[model samples]
Target: MTGERARVIVVGAGIAGVACARELAAAGVPVQIRERARVVGGRMASKRFDGRPADIGAAYFTVSDPDFARVVEGWRAAGLAREWTDTFVAYGADGRRAVPGPMRWAAPGGLRSLVTELAAGLPVTVDRLVLGVEPGPSVDGTPCEAVVLAMPGPQAALLLDPALADATRAVQAQQWTSTLSAVLRFPHRRWPDFAGAFVNDHPVLTVLCDDGDRRGDGEPVLVAHTTAEFAGRHLLQPTAAAAGVEEAVRDLIALPEPADHVHVHRWTYAKPAAGLPEAYHLDDDGVGLAGDAFGEPRVQTAWLSGRDLGRALARRLTA
Candidate 1:
């Protein structure tokens, strides 16, 4: 697909990029997705363990927008996703308690599969890292009619051409939080039956997910996300923090001790501290930004932001 570049080039093959490309393609505009990773699904990621795949990033996603609800409904009907839970157990120095929230959703093939499904048939160029864009809106020296950066604020800001210096500073002003995801596998199920638990006031752990129950087949695995502070402190040496996270996983879930094996993943930009108030941004040159950080850092927000940008860009191109 990279043999011939299209008029519109979307950098990043995550959900936002794919969704934007799909919309542009539907509008009779040719677009191609360029991703640095071998596969898509930025924070909505999954990786291999011993045999099966494990969700190492973004334990689950919640839907709120009516437009996003319709999208979720279709995914539900199509078997791309399922309701994970609405209530999660909250942890304190004292004990465990339940907290009710939005209906959380999960995918059988890990959250990454949903992005893969959404991007089906879309032209995606993987392992293609973008250096930066020229003011001509060129991507890595390849000129294109437009370029859509579907990534976090800081990462996107690095690609801004000098012509968009003001926008770059604005983008740079945005803040993001890092995360360390640890997935533990057990010889047998030993933890509580809760869907997920929120670890509060913990120095090491922040959130935990029962992967077995989540995947719908009931395999013995647990996924834990660490506090932003913890992740930042151990960003350079993520493994150094794994021992503490494992301890929390055991105690927070009322387990005896550590699991059989573990896998650790670091997210340098896991989530946004705050997103831009707008749904999307497009300078006069059609160079734009779309992602969860463009609005709210959620799965639905990413999709909506991308879709909205696509529609906006389509109108601009068709006009």
Candidate 2:
């Protein structure tokens, strides 16, 4: 490792962390991103399935805030994003209903592409698990000027230094349900009206999507997500539970039989019902906490929290 000390160390490479890093770097502050995962894009993510990029995290995010809309505009101009649809289908106890109006956007390659684009000019160190933070100096003896904990509140609490634990404890962390995402490729398309559906009150399935229709890729891919309750109950037995989920998805979408290929993914901290105190929380030592947990758990909230932290950090560094 280099003997040089970074002006700031941002933990986690999710949207919030990347945004904070980008904002800090743009302000001429030397920042380094340490991520536990092999690649960036904490939750707004994707992976290769059957030679095609499939989004297993956030299906698609909406641009509601003006500031976030500006960022989305930039992403669109850069060819990293495109409009998926303005209409959505909701599958509840009453059956499937088409709802039209709001504009929805998606990345051409996948959701992870957006995070990669945001981190283009930032220095990100992947596969570095930060067990905890120490007072005075880091384990390497590098006196970090500032530290940003940009992960779920519980995860952040685990890594907090003793000095900050009590204060941070007041910032209530809610219990969130998990999700199991199954990506399947089909020979022919199933749904007609919309690209996705919100299956309600089901035992195993929650959402199902026609990937081909959404991305205009012409390849039939079905992505099914398990409900939070179901995921938590069967997280350990994925292979055994996946068979039942596959069967449930087939029944929901009216598929003749099981899909061609099925991939199961488990997200321990999928969403947050409650959030931290503020958009950006700065400790007495100039350290900050930012992420989806800091604000609303939506994609826009994550971006907004990061932007807010970036602006705040820039002001602090300039002062």
Candidate 3:
């Protein structure tokens, strides 16, 4: 590691963190990213399942903002992203309903591909868990101009400096639930038309995706997501969760044979029901909080939050 003091240290390498880091670096600010995981993407990530990359976290994202749309366009041109579907089926207590014109998008390789592109050329340190933060200076004792906390609310709270936490008390963070995802590989293809399915009021299955159809990969991959209630109950048991999710998906898809392989993933902070109003929360003490928890629980919101924070920090630095 170089003995240089970074102008800003953006914690977490999820969409928010990477977006923030990209914006800050583009503005000519000396920035460093710290990620606890070996990979760069946090929740918008992927894992190898049965010799194929599968998205275990964020399946797809929607773009609404003009700026975000432009970014997606760039990604599309670079062959990193492609449209999944403009419509989706929502399953609820009543029944199944198809909503059109939603414009769901996905990365060609996996959601993590986009994150990797965002992290390109940025100084990212992986597997370094930040236990806590104190109000003082950088490790070298040089006063840090800014610090961006791009982690989930609970995570940020645990790592926040004592004084900063006190000042940001009013920034209430919503209680989140976990999710257990199972990527099941099948011998034969399934779902001829639809790429995904949202199953609600089901005991074990909440969402199921036909990964082959979704990514146009021509492989038999079924990604099953468990209900929040079920996930909370069996979050500790990976094998149990994976089995349950596989069974649920098999039933949902009415498969003739069992899946070849099953892989389970747990998301501690899946989504936030209620979030902070500010796009990016900031304190006069040079600490900022930005994440999907600060807005609607979505990839676009995470990106927007980080972009807003990066721009804010740039303005402050220039001033």
Candidate 4:
């Protein structure tokens, strides 16, 4: 570790944190990112399953905000993102219905690659798990001018100190849903031809996506997410949780049991019940907060929240 570097420590290397650091760096403000994971891209993570990459976190993002659209355009031109689909099949009491909406965008190398691209030149210290914040607004006791908790509201609530009681109260009031994801690997693709399936009214399966198709590789892998209710019942025993999720996916899609074993990952804070209107929030202590939970819960909202916070912190630090 260098004795002298950026005085700002941004925790959580997810899309929001990385986007914040990128904007701060671009504004000529020194910033350092600390991520608990071995690599950046927190929720937008992609892992190799059975030899191929699978998106186990966020499936895809929607672009609508003009500013976010501008950023997406840059990523698209750089070959980081491609349009996945503008339609999805929703399964419910009325049976399957095609729902047309905004064009959902995906990345060629998995969604995580897009976050990595955003963090290109920023200084990030990975594998540094932060526990809590101190009165100095330090992240686990590393003194810094400011600290940015760019993660889920529930996770961030745990790190906030009493010094920011107001922020803590607000964050604690936020409720988040959890989901269990199973990566089912198959020798050959055998599911119906759809971009992704929204398993409505299903007790176990909530969403299922063809990983190969999402990545635009035509590889045979499926990622299925369990309903929050189902996940809450089995989050502790995630491995055992995979059994039900895999079975539900198979039954819903009318596919045979996966030839290979299914891989499971749990998201304790999958989505927020409500979002704040503000882009970024800060307190008198120089501690700040930003993420999808603070604004609209989506990839673009997360990025925008981070960008706004980074710029605000830059001004405060430089003042």
Candidate 5:
């Protein structure tokens, strides 16, 4: 598939990249996705522990946009995704209280499976690291009609050449924060009954998700995301922070038992500190940028950003 004559080359095989490629393909445009990782999914990542999948990246997603809701419906019908919960417990000065909000969705197979589902049959090449994107609007000196960077701005900035001023400036203006996610596997369930919680004003923790509840399997596993400050301190050696994270979780829920195993994952550019007003950026140089950074950091936002960029590129190329 990599040998095909792809007019457009999409860097990053995350949901945004795959969504863009899917739209371009549907519009009869030729595009290919190149990902640095062995598999796609980007921030919506997952890991397996004892044969059970746990969400290690994004805990869950909320639906607001009608178009995105339709997409969610498809996933629900296909049994790739399910409604996890609408209420989450928030911890702060007032203490823990149930906060009702939009319906947050989850996947029984883990959130990554949703991206994998969207990427099926797409011309995606894994382990294909992009070196640079130059003025010819080419990738690694190989020219294409356009290049779509569907990743964090920090990552995309690495590939943009100084000559591509528009793209370079757009990417440079983006600021992102880091995070460390830890998955703790215990012998049995011992935490509270909540499926998820938002940790506010904490120096160590940011969010916690009951992996068992979210996965709909009740496997006695918990996933914790640390604050940017905490993550920054241990970015160099994320595993070392696992002990602190586990302790925070235990204390937060008053658990007496310790986790049998813990695994930590580092996301250097976990999420955009803020987002641009536009859904995506397409410059005259034929270099486009798409990701959650284009809007709020949500699964729907990433998909919409990529989908919009693909449609725009298709129209431009077809014209």
Candidate 6:
């Protein structure tokens, strides 16, 4: 790492962090990204089962903001992303009904690929966990022009020093929820033909996705996301929740054969309970915070939050 490089350190390699770094790099801000995970893509995670990848994080992403749309278009052009569906089945007291909305996008290689593509040519260090963010607006002991915490507020709060009153207060004010994603690989596709469904008002499951349909591969795999309440009960032993999750999925769709394989992933801070009006929080102390908590908890929102924060940081540093 050169002295001139990494003037700004953006923690968390999720879409938000990567998006922030992209903006800073575009503005020639010399930014560096540090991801504690082995790979990037925070919540937009994918795990492989029997050599086939299944989305275990964000089920799908939508495009709305003109800026985010353009970003999605680039991914589309590069064959990294594709339009998945515009409708989803909702299961509630009234029974199942098709809910039409914006077109949700998916990646053949999994959503994580999209982030990887976006972070191309940028300096990203994986498996490099940051211990602390201190008074000098520094990462661990390394000083930087600015520091962006592009993750869940709770996670950011852990790294913040109490002395950084403004940033600390901003993060502590945020509340988040947990979730568990279970991937069920079936021997064959016997479930409904829907691409995805909103398991509304369910105690166990909240969302279900046809992994085969979304990946455009037509495989007999399904991914189910558990409600925060259910996940909270199984956070300690996430794998122990797999059987219960699979049973609930089978009961919901009434499948004949059980899932041949099941894998579970836990998200302690899966989503924010509410969002602030601001796009991001950038304190005069040169400490910045960005994530979906700034708005609706969605992939686009997280990206926009980071993009806005990066621009703000760039302007401040440049000025």
Candidate 5 — worst ten consecutive residues by lDDT sum? Answer: 1-10
User: Each candidate: what lDDT?
Assistant: 0.86, 0.79, 0.80, 0.85, 0.92, 0.92
RMSD of each: 1.7, 2.2, 2.2, 1.7, 1.1, 1.1
Residue by residue across 1-319, what tens digits does model 5's lDDT show?
4456889999998889999999999988889899999989999999887788888898899899899899899999999999999999999888999999998999999999999999998998899989999888789988998999999988888888999999999998899999999999999897779989999999889999988889898889999999999999999999999899999999889999999999999999999999999999999999999999988999999999999999999999999
Compose the digit string of candidate 1's lDDT tens values, residues 125-218. 7999899988777888888888998988789877877786655766786789999999888888987779998988988888888888888878
lDDT of 2 by residue, 70-188 (tens): 98999999988888888778877888788786687888788889999899878898998888766653523456777887877777777766676542663345456688888887667
Model 6, 1-319: lDDT tens digits are: 3457578999999999999999898888898999999999999899877677789999999988999999999999999899999999999899989999999999999999999998888898999989999988899999988899988888898899999999999998899999999989999999877999999889999999998999999999899999999999999999999999999999998899988989999999998999988999998888999989999999999999999999988888788
Query: Model 3: per-residue lDDT, tens digit, 1-319?
Result: 2466788888889989889888888888888888889998888878876556788998789999999999999999999999998876766677667867687898768999899988888899999887766675242233577778787777777776567654257334556767888888888875445678788789888777878877788788888888788888886776777767777776665677888889888887788768777798877777877888877889999999999989989888877
- Candidate 4: misplaced stretches above 4 Å? 1-3
Candidate that beats the other on TM-score, 1 or 6, i.e. the better one: 6
Tens digit per residue, CA lDDT, model 4, 260-288: 77888989998887888778888877788
Better of 3 and 4 by lDDT: 4
TM-score of each: 0.95, 0.93, 0.93, 0.95, 0.98, 0.98
Worst 10 residues of 6 by lDDT: 1-10
Candidate 2 residues lying further than 4 Å off, grouped into runs, are: 1-4, 137-141, 170-172
lDDT of 2 at 163: 73
Model 3: residue 288 alpha-carbon error in angstroms: 0.8
| Candidate 2 lDDT score at position 227 | 84
- lDDT for 66 in candidate 2 is 88
Winner on lDDT between 1 and 3 is 1
Report how far off residue 41 is in candidate 2 (Å): 0.7
